[model samples]
Target: MNNISSISNPIRAPRAAFLGSNLHHHHHRLTILPRRPNVVVCSSSVSTPTSPSLSVAQEANRIGSLSQVSGVLGCQWGDEGKGKLVDILAHHFDIVARCQNEREAVKLFHEIKGATPNHVTYTTLIDGYCTINDLEEALRLCKVMEAKGLYPGVVTYNSILRKLCEEGRIRDANKLLHEMSERKVVPDNGGANAGHTIYNAEGKKFALHLVPSGILNEDTLCVIGNGVVVHLPGLFEEIDGLESNGVSCEGRILVSDRAHLLFDFHQEVDGLREFELAKSFIGTTKRGIGPCYSSKVIRNGIRVGDLRHMDTFPQKLDVLLLDAASRFQGFNYGTEMLREEVEKYKRYAERLEPFIADTVHVMNDAILENKKILVEGGQATMLDIDFGTYPFVTSSSPSAGGICTGLGIAPRVVGDLIGVVKAYTTRVGSGPFPTEILGQGGDLLRFAGQEFGTTTGRPRRCGWLDIVALKYSCQINGFSSLNLTKLDVLSDLPEIRLGVSYKHINGTPIKSFPADLRLLEQLKASGISYEVLPGWKSDISSIRNYADLPLAARTYVERIEELCGVPVHYIGIGPGRDALIVK
Candidate 1:
C-alpha cells in the first residue's frame, strides 16, 4: 500500500488530503478531499508492473492542470512532499514543469529511477536556479548535464551568462562565452587623449578616441582595458554614433570594471590645471585624462564596478567631487550638484550594465584559450609618460610594457610588436621636436599629409622623419617589424630628408635622445644632422605590391630599415583599408 501525503495551506485549508492510487491496468484516479476551491494539485505518475500509474488521458488532464498554477511557484507550506511530486513527474514528462522553492526537488529528479533528464529538463531546472539567484547550483546542473552526455545549448548557457553578467561576475561570463566558442577580443590600452582614425573598406572614415578600431568587425570584442580612464558620456556618444551608422555595438563592446571613471568635474579640473600652467601647459586635448589618472593614482578614484552599488555610489562620488572642489576653486560642488550627478549616474549605470566586464579575466582567458587577440595601443611611444619628452607627455604608458599592465595579460603571451610610423613626422602640441620644420617647408608637408589632429582638429606641426627618435623607440618597444604609413605624402617632393643624428650647441655629436628638456631645447636650436635622400616623386598610392614601388621609394624604405634595424613589413600608401601594401 502506497501512502498519500496531506498538503496543508495555512491561510486557506487546515488540512487537505491529496489522494491518488492505482485503479485498473495502467490507470489511476486523483481525488482532492475537503474540496477547497483555491487548492491547486499538480502531479504526475508512471506505471510499473507492481507500482501505481496514471492513464494517458488522466496524465494529460493532470499536466493540463499546470495552467491553473501560477508561473512562479511559492512553496509556502513546510515539507509539502515537493520531492515526491517531482519524482513522480520526472519519469513521465520531458520537463519537470515546476519550480519548487527548494533544491531537494531538483536533486530528487536527478536521482529518480527511469527518469532520464534531457537538455530541456536540465535547462528548466537551471533557469529556475538562475531565477532564485542560486548560480552555484545552476552551474553544477550544467556540469552534470554535460557529464551525462547532454550538451547544454544556447538557452542553457544564456541563462547562466545573463545571471553572471547581472551580478558583475564578468570573468565567469567570459569563461562561459569562451566555452560557447565566441573568441576574438581587441583591447585598448590608452585613454581618450589619443585618437585613431580608421578607414573602412568603403572609404568611410571613423575617428575613434576611447573605442578600439576593431569595432568595425562584427565578430571582434572590443575591450576598454583597465589602464584606460573612461568618460561615460563620451563612450556612450561613440556607441550611439556607431549604432546610428549601422554598426551594432550591443555585445561587441566591453568596458573593464577595474577602469577608472572620468567625470565631467575632472574635465573642469583639467582646464584649471592647464590655466595655472599658462604657457607651459602640456598640450593635452583637455579631455580630463590627466586629472582622471591623477585621481586613480591618488587612490580616490571610483571604478566602473562602483556603478553596480548605487547605494554607496553617492558617497564614493562625493569624495571624488570634494577632492576636485578643494583643489580647484573654479570647480563647483554642493549638495544639489551631488544630487544631480547621482541622478545622472543612476541612468548611466542602467545603460552601462551590458558593457561592463572583467577585461583582465577576458584577456588572460583569451590568451590561455589560444584565441587570437589584438592589443591596440592608442598613443605613440613619443607620447609615453616615462619614455617620451617630459612635461609634454600623456599620462599613461603607451609602450609594449603597457600591454601587459593594461590588459592584465602575461608578458610571455605578447607576440610580434608592430611599430607604426609615418614616412614624415608630425606633432600636435607643445613638444621638443628636434626635426620640426619651422617655415613654408612644414606648411608644404602639412598640406600634403593632411596633418591635423583627428580629435582636437588642430593642425599638426610637420617635420622630417626623426631616425634618432625612431631608433630609440624601436629599442624601447623591441618591435619585430614596422609599418611605414603615408609614403604617398612625399610624392610631390623633389627630395626627402631624415633627421639621422642630434648635435650639441658646442659642435659635439649627441649619442641618444636626451632626457633633459633643456638639452633637447639646445639640440633643436643648434640644428640636427640630416641625411637627404632622392624622392620617388611618382604616385605610389596605386601600387599594391612592395616590388611595384619606385626605385627611389625602395631605396628610401631600405634606408629606414637599415637605420632602425627593423624591417618594414607593411606600407600604407593611402588612407583607405585597401591602400595598405604587405611586404
Candidate 2:
C-alpha cells in the first residue's frame, strides 16, 4: 500500500527475509495463518499443536523466531521424503529475486511480523520509513508502538533524522531532535547519526580550517582593479585608524606596479561623462574606475610605476590630457592648465614612490617564503564584468578570476577563497534586484545596516538574500567558506523573508540562473518564493561567540548554510573589525 509497490509496504521487519544454502525444514507445509488480528504466523505442522488458535506472537514464543525458521527445520522430525518436499519449495523462498523495471521483498516481513512483533520488529519498520524520507510517518508509528509499551529506541530516531538531513530537510530533522531532548533519548551509537551526516558533509571537500588572524609577517598586500579603486583606500585608512587604536597591520602594504592609477582628474572626467555626455548613464562611482580600466586596455594608461620617471610621465600626461580634452566637451584644458597639472603630478609621484614596487615578484617571493596571502575581492559577483548583469555591470572583473590578472599573481598561488556577503542583499548605484524590498521595509534595512556606498555615499538598494544568485557565486568561486555580515540588521524585523528560488510568469521554474538578463530579471519580477524565519530580539552585534547567538539567528544562519552548501565560518555582528563570531 505504498508508492513503491508491495515490497515497500512500510512494514518490512528485520528477520522477515534471509539468504543461505541447502536450507530445509522437516515440516512439509508452512502455514500463513492470521492467528490474531494483525499477525501472520509461519510455522510447521510436523507436530500437532495443543491449541490451533495460537497467535503468531504465541507461536514465536513457543518456538524460536528467525534463527529457528531460517536454516534446517527439525532434526527430530527429519525424514528424507519430507525434506525433499521442503527442499523443492525452497526454490520459492531461497531463490534470489532481482526485479528490473518491476516490484518485489515484503513476503518474508509478513511472516516474521505475526510471530515476534517485538522491539526489533517496530524499529525495523521505522527504518523502512526513514529510507523513504518519511520521518513524520515513522514518528507516528513509533508513538503507536510506544503506547503498546515497546520502546522505538534511539536507533530508530537517529536513522530517520540522519536521512532527513541528507536531503536538506534539517529543519524538520531538528524538530524530532526537540522531541528526543524532551524524552531524554540519547543516541544508540557514537554521538548521534545526525552528527555523522554533518561530519561527512564537512569531510575533506569542505573541512573548516582556521589560522591565526594577521599571520602575514612580511606585510598585507591588496590587489586593485576598477574593481578596487573605490574600496581599498577606505579599508586601508580604517586599518590605519585601528593602528591608532593599538591594532596595527604590522606589515607593509603593497600596490601592484602595473595597476592603472585613479587620479583626481579621472573622477572629474567620470562625473562629467556620466552626467553630461552619454545617452545612458553607466551608473558609475564617478571615481573614474571604468575610464582608468579603459585607459589600461588601450595601452595609454599611466600606472603606479610610471610615476618614477617624471620626465617621461609629463609627455604621457600631455597626450592623455589632450585626448581626453578633445573627447569630453565639458573639459577645456589650456596649455597653462596642463603645465600646472604636470607640476602637481610630479609632487604626487614623489609621495607615491615609497609604496610602489614590482609587486608581482613580491607576491611570488612571499609564496616561496611560505607567507600567507589573503586577497580581498572587489565588488560583488553580480557586478562582475563578464558573468554579471550586462550594461549595468562594472567595467573590470571582481570575480576570483580577476585576482590573477589584476594582481599579476598566478592562479595557483591563491588559497582559501572566502566570500563576504551580507545577511540580506544590497547593491550600489543601479541594477536589477530580484528580491528587492522597494518600500519602507528596504529603507528600514538600509538605515539598520548603514547600506550606503563607501565611494559615493549613495544609499544602496536593498533586498532579501537571493539563493539563485548566491548559488551562482558559490559555484564560480568554489568558496571554502563564507563570512556573513550585517545579520544584526534583521534583528528588529519580526519576521524575515528569504528568497529560495525563481519562477517565470507562467509559473515554470527557472532550472538554473538564466544568462539572459531580461529573463533573469523576469524570473524575479513578481515570482521568487520565500521561506520566512522569525527574527531575534537580542543585539547580536556585541555577541562575540556564535553559540551565544539567539535561536532565531541560529536558524537563519543554518538555513543559509543548508541552502548554499557553504558554512558561515565567521559571522559579523557589528561594524568594528572585532565584532566577529567565529564558528
Candidate 3:
C-alpha cells in the first residue's frame, strides 16, 4: 500500500516531475482517503446520507467559468476543498485576473459558465501547447484565434519564439522575429529584436464595449443522452439524415457538461466482467456504458468539462485506472498502462471541449427566452432504472422522467411525453422479452427491420409488439403521443401479433407486466397471450400520410392506439429519411 492514498481525497500530490512548469505544487489535503484507494469520491466516515441543499439547476447557475485567453483561467469543478475558496472570492472580481501559472489560470477560466475568450485566452493556450512541444496544434490554434480577430499579444509571440530557439530551430525563430518587426509588434524588453518592446502594444483587434442586451429567443435545441457513448459528428450526421418533418433540428445542440466520459478502459472492463464474474451471459454492448455509470454512481466519474481542463485529469484518471487494474486479476495494467490512458483521454478531452456547456443553464435560459427545447432520450421505458426489470436494465434512466433528472431541468417545465414503440418488438443483449418470436418468424422480422445494435452490431431478438409492456410503460411515462417505428417490417406477413397478456404455467393470468426478473423470465418461458391482426402485403414506404396507409395497416395502428390509449402521431414505414407517415 506504499502508493495507496485515501479514496476520499485521492488527488495525488503532483510529483517532482511537474515542479518546474505549472502543475507540481499545491495538492490540497482533505479527509483521509481509503487505504486501498477507493476510486469513488464519497466520505467513508459519514454514516448518514445528506440531502442536497440546492437543486442541480441552482448549483449550475452559481458555478461559472470564463475561458482563459491571455492568462491562467478559472475554477476546478471538484472536491478537495478548493471550490469553497473560489465561491467566496469569485464575486469580488470584475475583470478576469491572472495567476502564477497556467494551472490556476485555466481553473479561473473554467469556473465561469458562459464567459467568452479573447486575446488572453488564445495566448495562454498557445503557450500551453508550446510547453508540451505540440507546436503544431499550438500554431493551428493561434491561427484560428487570429482568424477570429483576436491578435496574439507580445507574450504570445515571445513564448513561441523562445520555445523555437530552445529547440534550436533558429530559422523558424528568425522568421517569427521578422514577422514581429514587420507587424510593428514589440518583443518583451527587445528580447527578440533590437528596438521597442511589444509588451505595451495595444490589442485593438477585438472590441471591448460592454452593453446591456436583451434575452435571445432560440429555436428548438435537441439533446441526446444515456446508454450510449458520445459520437458528436455522427450525431449531427444522424440529425441531418432524419427527415425534417417540416421542422429541422440541424442547428445548435447543447450537450450536458455533466455527462460522464466513456473511455476505452470501460469497454475492456465490461467484456471481462461478463466473461469472468457473471453466473450466466447477460449480453452487453461492451461499450463501457455500465462501467462508466458505475463510476458515476460511486462519484468518481470524469465529466465532459474534465476534458477541457485536463490539468487535473491525470490525478482523477490515475484513481480510475488504478482501481480497475487492481479489481481485475486477469488484466495487465500499471503506471505505464495508466500513462497510456492519460494521453488517450487527453486527446479525447481536447476533441470534446468545444461542445461542452452547462445544459442546466441552456434549459433555464431557453425557457426564459421562450424557446422550444426538446430533450431526446436514448432508450425506451422498458430500460428505465427504477421501473424497468432490475439486473436486466440499461445503466441509465431512459424514460421521460429521466429527461429532468439527466438534463437538470426542473420537473414543473417537463411536458408532452412522447413514446416511440416499434411495430414489432426487438431488444439487444440479454433481457427477458415476454413476446419474443423465437423461430423463423423472429429471424424474418429481425432481418426485415435490420434489428441490430448500431455500435455493437449484435443481432437483436425480435418479437410481436408487447401491449402488456406497452400499457405498463404508458402508465409510468404518461405518453401524449406515440412514434411507432418499423411498421413496414410487419408488412407482407400473413398475420401480425400483439402480446396482450401473460399467464403463468399454472393456468392463472398475471395482473400486469411483471417487474420481477425471475417471473418475467418464467413468463417468457411459459408464453404470453397475443391478439392477432391480418397483415397488409402492400409496400407502404412511399405513403406520406397516415390516411393513405392500407386498410390493414390502419386497422393495426388504430388497434394499438385503441389499446395503448395514445395517438400514434408518427409512423415509420421504411429506413429512409422521408419514410415516415405523420398522422
| Strongest candidate by TM-score | 1
Query: lDDT for every model?
Result: 0.62, 0.51, 0.51
Ranking by lDDT: 1, 3, 2
Tens-digit lDDT string for candidate 3 (476-525): 77777676767887887866766777787786878887776666766655
Off by over 4 Å in 3: 1-253, 347-351, 524-527
Output the worst ten-in-a-row residue range by lDDT, candidate 3: 207-216
Ranking by TM-score: 1, 2, 3
- Residues 214-273, candidate 2, lDDT per residue (tens digit)? 212112233232223322233345445445644434434444556566566676676565
Q: TM-score each candidate.
A: 0.66, 0.59, 0.58
Please identify model 2 stretches exceeding 4 Å from their true place.
Answer: 1-251, 277-285, 454-457
Task: Estimate, for each residue in 362-440, the C-alpha lDDT of model 1 and write its tens digit.
Answer: 7767666655455666456776678877656667766777777777777776666667788878765445666777656
| Shift in Å, residue 16, candidate 2 | 41
The TM-score between candidate 1 and the true structure equals 0.66
